[model samples]
Target: MKLTVRSSTISEGEWDQFILAESPWAFFQSFAWGETQLLEKVAVARWEFLLDDRKIAQAQTILVKAKRGTFLHVRHGPVVNRELVNDNLLWRQILEFLAAEAKKENAWFCRIGPLLANTQETQRLFANLGVRPAPIHAMDAEYTWVLRLNEAEETILANMRKTTRYLIRQAEKQGVVVKASHQIEDFLRLYNQTAKRQRFVPHRGIEAEFAVFSKRGQAELLVASHSGQQLAAAVILYFGKQAIYHHGASIVSKISASYLLQWHAIKEAKKRGLEWYNFWGIAPEDKLEHPWQGITLFKKGFGGELRSFVHAHDLPVSPLYPVSATIEAVRKRLKHY
Candidate 1:
């Protein structure tokens, strides 16, 4: 069968329908995400691959124009309908299409972080295509902890580590309150404090993120407080059947308010009839000294399956690609990611 690729200017509903129907769905590939990028002054393009007039694969590519250079990024996607025709030809055609799109967009390179499992076969496939591992991850995490949310609340609590359960109860007993709101100022205040304490740069576009997602009714800001003082805050995104713990921040306090905060988020996910609660990212087990080790331990205590996705792959489209690569390589090392 001859495969053809074309750009899409489809409605958000149409795009979402295709994305939700595929396995391993991710909000990063959703049309709303594209809109978020647009709000950040980034350009986004959606492409679809058709086999005999039937859509078989789709990707929402974002054009990230930095001071260094411009690069195309596809996060957790190029969702392909494997039941239709799962073969190398489909992927090769998709790559060729992306390369063409990159050239047209004047992008220096293209980075893809597909939702494929991190396995020898997946690595080999990208390697064979002459794609190199991205110096820095396009998404901060290539591995995540995910919990199935179909079970009853008691059963879910019973499955958690004893320590995690205890912490949640302790926070509750201490009068920790978790509240959901659409307000961004309070979350931003706490988030900035977290960035300062952690010695990391906070995402500057967070307000835009909250504004866009909340307007669409697909996001929420959950705040944890004790004695009327905020202790932690999180931004959660709901898409398809999953509720993602997209971003979080906390003050350096002795209180275990964050535990109950997370528990409340899980309950909210269940309340929304979501089938999965995704604890966005975690460090690999072997990387005991990794920067994410502390949070990884905390996430694991809640009990969930670990999912590893294929590492980000870069396909150079311009001669200037090496310069960006070199800069990112140093940045990656400095960030300890």
Candidate 2:
């Protein structure tokens, strides 16, 4: 089986459809995501791997300009077709091409976050490619939570934690309401409030993300309200077979509007006939004190299986990469990530 990689010039619909039809679950690798990156001042590109001219895999990469080191970042990507997931040679070839491209662009390294299982064979594959675990904790959602949507609504609610179900019901009885929104500002207002309260920097270009994906009918913003007061909001990315709760925010309130908001999103996903509702990232079960622990408990209460991926790996191109890695390790420790 001959394999070759080339720059992708496919139309946006075709690009997204290929991802939905052929690859693992990763909306970050979707075509609309690249456009969002571009709007955020991150240059992006897409590549397609072909098996004798038949497209088999695709990767969306961004050139991250950082003072520490400018590297090519593959955030949860190089999504391979399920059939070729076990083909080590193809994965190696893909990385070889990406690493070469990074060097040509003067990048210090090529950092990839593949959606492969955290297993022994996966370890061996990256090891053979000379990749080391990245110094930063995660490039994206390396350990995510997902709830399958094929079950009956009663069953789904029954499976959730008792407290979660109670909270959701309480919100409903208290007259909390969730509605679909086209306005990004509605979500952004709450999102910004959350970032400040949590002492974390909110990501730039969420508006751009909403615009790009919403234009394609691949996104929705859900807002939870009571007495016309916006209590909580969330942005759900509908990609592949999942409706992912990718971003969220809420004001401090005694009411359990956030819980109701999540339930609303799940029902929306089920209404849309999605296969899963992805809760995005959670702290590793082993790291009880990680930054995401609180929210992790919140997400876990909704009832879902944990999906752990091999950590992001760095394929070094320049000797400066080692220095950059050292600095990153220090920063990660300081952040407790």
Candidate 3:
């Protein structure tokens, strides 16, 4: 079969529709995500792959330039048609195409975090292509906690940890109220405070992200307050059939307000006709010392199945890649990942 690839200037609606309808669809692969990256001064490219002129796969890659070197990051992609993904030849062609594109962009390496399950077979597939595990995650979450929203709210509550359930009830008894709004000012105030307390760098593109997603009517800010004081907040992104708990922050409070906030967000997601609620990112059980450990425990308390994606893989395209890799490796170690 003849393989061909080409860049598309217009939005590939057919491609997105097909991919988003598939299982494991992620917001990063959506057309709007590329636009959001553009607002952050990052370059994005959309490509379509064909086998005998039949569309087989598509991907949107974000080119990120750092002080050390540039790299292409493909998060939760390239969304391949189910039938083509298993075809060895198709995978080869896709990687070859990505490498060529990376070379053209002067990227030191290309990183791919496909939405495939983390299994031995999946690891071998990428390993066979000479891809190595990346030092750090390209997206915030490599493993996520996802809840199916088909069950009744009571059933959902019953499935949660007793502590989580009690906390939610306690928050209510303590007069905690969760409010959903489009305003970012209030959320940012709490977000900044959370960052300060947690000692992590806040994402610099949150404003641009909110602006883009809100314009599409696909985002909401949920804040938990008690006695007229904000205690916790989150920016939830509604994409396809899933509601993503994208960015969140909370201050130290004794009111259990965060629990109420999460429960409220889940209910809001169901109200919007969403079928899934993704509590994005959690540390693996073995990585007890990982920076996300505390929050992961908090997320797990709500009761959801753990979905582990294949770790990010790197395809080195330049000699400078090792330097960047070393820096990333050191950073990961220092962060206790």
Q: Roughly what TM-score does model 3 have, to 2 decimal places?
A: 0.96
In terms of lDDT, the best-performing candidate is: 2
RMSD in order of candidates: 1.7, 1.6, 1.5
- Tens-digit lDDT string for candidate 1 (204-267): 6788877888988899999999999999999998889999898898988889988999999999
Candidate 3 Cα lDDT to native = 0.85
Estimate, for each residue in 1-337, the C-alpha lDDT of model 3 and write its tens digit.
Answer: 6678889665546645856865355678888788888998899999888777877787889998999789998888887887666566678889889999999999999988778877888888887888898987435466888999998999999999999999999999999989987789888998898889889988888888899989988899998989999899999998888899999988887889989999999999989998899999888788878888889889988888888878888899999999999999898889887
Task: Put down candidate 2 lDDT per residue, 74-157, tens digits, no spaces.
Answer: 987788887787787888888889999999889999998878898998888888877899998764778889999999999999
After best superposition, candidate 3 residue 114: deviation in angstroms? 0.8
- Which ten residues in a row are the worst by lDDT in model 1? 82-91
The whole-model C-alpha lDDT of candidate 2 against the native structure comes to 0.89
Q: What are the models' TM-scores?
A: 0.95, 0.95, 0.96
Q: What local lDDT score does residue 41 receive in model 3, on the 0 to 100 scale? A: 89
Error of 2 at 254 (Å): 0.5
Per lDDT, what order, best first? 2, 1, 3
Task: Report the number of the highest-TM-score candidate.
Answer: 3
Each candidate: how many clashes? Answer: 0, 0, 0
List residue ranges in candidate 2 displaced over 4 A: none
